[model samples]
Target chain A: MSDKGMNLTLKIWRQKDAQSQGKMETYQIADISEHMSFLEMLDVLNEQLISEGQEPVAFDHDCREGICGMCSLYINGEAHGPDRGVTTCQLHMRMFNDGDTIYIEPFRAKAFPVVKDLVVDRSAFDRIQHSGGFVSVNTSGNTQDANALPIPKDDADKAFDAATCIGCGACVATCKNASAMLYVSAKVSQFALLPQGKVEAKDRVMNMVKQMDLEGFGNCTNTGACEVECPKGISLDNIARMNREYLKAAIDK
Target chain B: MSVVSEDTFNSTSHFMGTNAVVQFVLQPILAFGVIFHLSMGIYLDTQNNKARSVKYAMNKPGTNSSWMSRNMKITGIMILLFLGLHFYDFWIPELNTKYIVGDMSGLNEHGGMRYFEELQHKFADPIWVILYVLSFVFLALHLLHGFQSAFQSVGFRHTKYTPIIQKLGNIYAIVVPLGFMFIAIFHYVSQL
Candidate 1:
């Protein structure tokens, strides 16, 4: 760790609300510690703004350790500030050099509207989740033992991989089409893969896809950028699986 | 020969080795594949549009996917429009002369109709030739993204195989359209 801090130029997006037009506001910061997390650097900037009697930039973040999926920003043309397999909070100032101009903006998608500076309404994801992201499980104590089900190793592994999706909307943010196929597919696969959830698999897939389409997202063109930007490293195979499931359900109906 | 329709495009070469098998079975399957692919492309484009009600105020698509991927629907629509004109120019006339008019004598000596002469006649007009060639250009652009994406959509993706598929797709996108364009230009220039 160097004792000297780095100075940087930041071009950040600032908007009072969703209805107002936004623009880039440039600011220069001095002596920023390289060891600081990207969010901490923002905090320093906010502190400076408050001290100067100005309103601080508004952004979304929670569980900075990267699991909660709340921290969302398009940093320097990337979902998480030029980092792979990490969220915005996981990004560090060390990734930038002194005097670098870092551009910060909210994730731009028709489905995801910018509420303020670097925060957008990600409730679209929640609506997709609410559509059909769960299995109808019995809460009764007489429920059958989960361990007794003999799921194949391959299926179990694939299901586990699909379940890791954090619904961060990096998939939507990074996709050229702004498609939520990756996020919706992961949620569908999480339920569709197991025998416990197989009972309502048909409705689960159809309803979720309908909701996704209704949410004003874009279609998956298989550009594969979503998987590249995903912090959890979600596979494109999940989308393929969901497509297959959707087709089967459609045919059955 | 009995099962093969003389009105169908040249099936004499038996590119699949067995003439009887290729003419009777393979040709129809190939036709079906072409029609299904075109129909599916249109259907998917409709779904793609419905997914987004409002357009983004600011979008930097080049940051992620290629321009071809971003504009596939436009390219696909261009190709589809071209196909309609193509079938009207060639297939409809052949069908009319062979089945409706019941005259094979004035048609191409190849059997039902003279495809070679028909092409020569159509390409004689420089405007038709130019439009024909432009359609192939659109076809190439569409194929640039479509060829590899078709494989991915069907779940045929792998690290080693994907690069090979993409390389082959690029070659097919360029070479196939270029080949068709060459044929049109060759006929047009020969007529002049």
Candidate 2:
């Protein structure tokens, strides 16, 4: 725990760009501070690469505080680097030991194509949300009174829980089938649970699910893996709720 | 239990093997269901694999999902292999008698029902017994994730009722395979 930090071996996937092939390249670090966040440790590696006249690794990160949902890496094997309830940015170097061989790769799925070494395109999530991730409220100066609508405590709380999903692709990366059901379900549940989202609930579930399928994500086999690896610990109940919503919407339509 | 008494076994087997409804209606429906399930599973497994064209260098799937849930395709293929052997052992013979050879009499040369003796003769082989028992284990694994999963696919989920269904699914998964295994071992042991 003194000034002599941990010496580590890093196996990182290096890709020139989306079209180029990728491979795991090994690197060595002499002293990595355990207090450094996983992203910060990568920064050290990139800085080392720059000084050595080698190409730096490409990765995604924003809001190092873990709020932006932009940081993504499949560290070792688990998404967000083996820690629970935290994104890769929040993962610390302390989780590993000295001389540990750490494998770092991008969050992978056909829907989330690898843009570079550790950056995958997650715009597929955006497309699904675009279809029906919102409520149609009047904002043309005829806005309704916000406080007038009262949602029950239980329903509001559940909605808030569902709303906490940051649209990260970790669920897809962790899933064996690479299913996006959890992410889609969280969005569907957030809206389907409240009065503001009730009017278009059926159409919302229908369109979002349709878009999700169009994105080529695999079907859910109810493995419950996504829920376990989710950084926000989003409940599997949201998936069940989405199933119910989708079924009802399909039936009524 | 049937192996202990020739008369009891023949009566029960003859009843089931010769009954018009069991032969004509139930068997056809059961056959269709098994074929449909196997085909659908193969189709989905292939499609899912195609979704992930590239493989990961290191993956620890056991950390997040149960082994049974993650390896459905493997267990499913195991069950498929078992079914091929099972149909050869039992269904082929039944088809030979009922349709090809046209012996629906359920009789032996001595003018007695042969169902009990035929059943015993099949289990007399140690290899068949061992293979059948091993297949039942795979069946149990397949059902462990499958039973509740089917309900989930149909969207029959509730806070109070879902947990109950999952528990019931586990019981069903265990008991059905256990029942098959017990009968298999019992028949093989009783013959000696």
lDDT for each candidate structure? 0.81, 0.90
Total backbone collisions, model 1: 3
Task: List the candidate 1 regions with Cα displacement exceeding 4 Å.
Answer: A1-4, B1-60, B77-137, B151-175, B182-192
TM-score of chain A of 2: 0.98
Where does candidate 1 clash, by residue pair? Answer: A217-B51, B108-B113, B108-B114
Give the per-residue Cα lDDT of candidate 2 at B35. 89
DockQ of predictions, in order shown: 0.29, 0.71
Tens-place lDDT per residue, model 1, B1-192, is 212343343333223323557645886898898889878767777666654444343455566667787788778778778878977986576557745877545445555445444556787899988988998998898889999988877656666788899999999999999988887787787767
In candidate 1, what are the lDDT values of residues A1-253, reduced to their tens digit? 7757988988899999989988889998889988899999999999999999998999999999999999998888788878789899999888988889888888877788889888889898899888889888788878888999999987888888999998889898877667899999999988788998799999989999998888888778887789888999998888878888888998999
**Model number with the top lDDT:** 2
Error of 2 at A237 (Å): 1.0
Interface RMSD of each: 3.3, 1.0
Question: Model 2 chain B, TM?
Answer: 0.93
